[model samples]
Target chain A: MTDLLPRSGGPDPASAPGPVRRPFRDLSAEGRGRAGGRWRRGRVPGSLLSRVERRERRWSAGPAPAAPASRSLLAALLLAAATVTTLDLSTDHGPVEAARGVVADVVGPLESGTAALVRPFTAIGDFFTSRSALRAQVAELQAENDALTDQLATADVDTRRLATYDALAAEADDLDRAVVAARVVGWGAAQTFTDTVTIDAGTEDGVSADDTVIAGDGLVGRVLTADSSTSTVVLITDADSTVGARVGSSGTLGFLTGRGEVSDGATLDLELVDSTEVPDRGETVLTWGSQDGAPYLSGIRIGRVTKVYSSLRDSSVRVEVEPSVDMTSLDVVGVIVPKGTDSARGLITGSSGSSDTSGSDG
Target chain B: MSPVRTLVTGAVVLAALLLQVVVAPHVAWHGVVPDLVLLVVVAVALARGPQPAMVLGFCAGLLVDLAPPAEHVAGRWAFALVVVGYLAGRLRPDVAPTALSTVATVAGCSFVGASLVALSGLLLGDPAGVGTGELMLAVLASVVWDVALTPLVLPPLLALLRRLEPGPA
Candidate 1:
């Protein structure tokens, strides 16, 4: 029974006295003469023997001589990382920002190239995920197209209405303000937790920080930082972002705050200034332009009021809004450059009539 | 590390960054993308031990911090990944690794990395106002995604790095 159990001592079976019948696999193929060579050839593969030899070498080496130096190197790197974090947090826009800008500029073109390369693959993914929805949309669009074609056949009345509609659209779009068109080259938060995107256009293209970004559908976001050829746009769905909004036709003022989500079900929270005024469901929300239109432009459609909750304790209403633009599938966007100081004069004179009409039509 | 190996490491890091920036968002499950850079860093630690791994982690983290679309303070990822690399390096097994142990190591390192980032954000006051629950959720998601990705990324990466420089011979 004792012979059946292998010894807990070293690999050398010779040290143990009388006829210890060791397993063939347990014997090391070193210093055992002919029997070891026979066992090695018959049972253990060449690769296994080499692996065991390597393990033995590693065990004999104990700790590598380079261990202390590596430890010091790790400490130094950790300290450097800490220093960078402190500098970035404490200062407004310092050397770290500059370094970040440099990195952005370097990586921007590469990102855009990769995005273009991968667009078709991602589109295929989207197609499979939303195949049923796409089919429904195609049917809806086909019906709409047929109706529009029929309207076009009655040219005279339709043409006049179209002219009037185009005029209204131009005014609502703030046509006087310059906009730089750009493609969204990258997505995800990168290192930060905020929801953001990288756009191809930047300061070189007259895009700058605090500029309003918009898609064809509605407001997209605001530019947070601009490099020479690229910029970071903080989406409206980012947790820290807030846009002043005008609710319904009454022009009741409110603030739309992001909840930091970008799924199809993501929604913004609207807090009305007048808590007693309950906004009806489906009321349209539009941007109440900021001072000088730096961060957000006025009259742009934000979303519709999906749900409203009346709070008993504070007597305040919490309204939920589904954004007009799909935050998850951003593509081409425009950065609204604040018209020069000279254009400010034009805005003031044209303000009164436009501001009132900017309400629900958007 | 030899110059050729260093170059290979640099190339791998750059490729991981590009993938994270361009492809990650498209592949995000519930708005959480796996950290490819972190996975690569951890893999390197497992392959080469602590010193090279920390250096690679710091460099990779700094790049991630400075990458476009990043809005928070820089170096947060750098600090987080440095600790991740060191701990992962220390966790390296002396014997040949089984698949289960490798998966466990990747999951543990990923959890620690995600937790450190959340903790740093909490201490420094995240502007996003992420709550404890949300932070924990993010950490959990990161771990799940990374662990899921380990089979696809880690084995190929480990094999490649091992080929680049044979272990401590």
Candidate 2:
């Protein structure tokens, strides 16, 4: 700000700038007439000078600040208005498959089916896990199953697969009951081998683009594009799929971005931008929250973080992740529409959570 | 020229664009999103022959850039879509482009686009961490979307084109 100072000056401009006091000092210009004229307007100019000085002080303290306060206020008001308008623009949420409401309907069936189908498989796979308790549980399930029929006992195995399956089941049920559903009507003729799947849901279905789409286990991908009655779903396993996540048990926050496609049981890497909490091999990765600009809903499971590595440049750890769902065989899915736009940060988190990015603001 | 036919086609195009904006968003493959702009071009070309398709493609591309964050040069998209429209015009509506073909086209185009974008880093001697694997996944996602949804749009659009053309069945 002082870059504007001259090489040599008659008066110290910092204490009293020339722009404010120039007219008074320049009275030598017209001698008597100029001095007499200045006397009449003296008080007015002095007050105006004080006002200008105060403004300059504020201006010199920061760069391009006036624009942001006013702009952000305007943006806030506009965002508020948009949110209110969105609230009223409710999705009729009809049962027809032509729109996204079917997504709501399908979420329940798909999640439960996924939970039911994948539970036993993951459990049996985990049966040989190094834990004796796990082996004992499997043994108990086998003993229980020996007395029952094979089909009847398998449902029991789903029940006995440990808390992970239970969490998955409950989460799946919640996803089913709490989402919008869409039919797999239009597949882009060319790009069918992708993590993205287009459905017959759209903005009119109350399904805004960018809402997180999920299944029984947890996060998949968010809606990147939308139409009136159709949208595209990007799966979490997509190499480019990235979301802000946290270790559910540890609360260690980080962004979990997809590494690449898994091949032949090989693990896909999930790079973490932070490592405040060292995520164990088995800790569940969950979305941080909508407040952090999550593309998906809060608490939607993404995957379990694995293969931890520390980067030399930063303190954060890089890890591998496996999405909760089988990207290869997705049949139906759920769209978790963000509930409301007017956040409770100001109203709930109090002054602490609403801190600005810069501490320089006084 | 029939004003009715023109209006109908215009409506279809608008609907497609609007749907692309509103509906097609939910199904994107993270950063590797499906190209609704590309989809509209391919469908229109398959439906209404070439010259008209090229014009429509330019318009759709512009609309895409105007999406959430409007672009400075909508004209740039006009260039890309014109090519997509022209190439699609040459392809047969009768044959289905395979999942691989869609991936190949999108991946090739995205690679070129990505390379153009990478120039921002290159000039500064800071070549970006171009996640080759992730981008390929995106290309694959685009292929999946294009293949899965083409029929839904193409069948209706091709039929509409037949109706507009002065020919005997």
TM-score of chain A of each: 0.68, 0.42
Clashes of 2: 52
lDDT of 2 at B42: 62
Q: Cα RMSD to native, each candidate?
A: 8.9, 27.5
Give me the runs in candidate 2 sitting further than 4 Å from their true place. A1-177, A184-212, A223-242, A248-251, A259-277, A292-298, A311-316, A337-362, B1-53, B59-78, B84-169
In the range B80-166, model 1's lDDT, one tens digit per residue, is 888888887877633234456678888988999888887887888766677787778888988999999987898778767757864
Clashes by residue pair, model 1: none
Tens digit of per-residue lDDT, candidate 1, span A1-362? 12223334434544443214433212332312122132332234587776664433222212121232267777899899989998998888789989989999998878888888988998898888678878987997899699768866874655654554465457555435655778898886522467899998877777778988999888999999988888999999888999999875556899999987777768999989888888878677888877767688777888889999998998979999999898887888887764342221122223423333223210
C-alpha lDDT of candidate 1 relative to the true structure: 0.75
Q: lDDT of all predictions, in order shown?
A: 0.75, 0.46
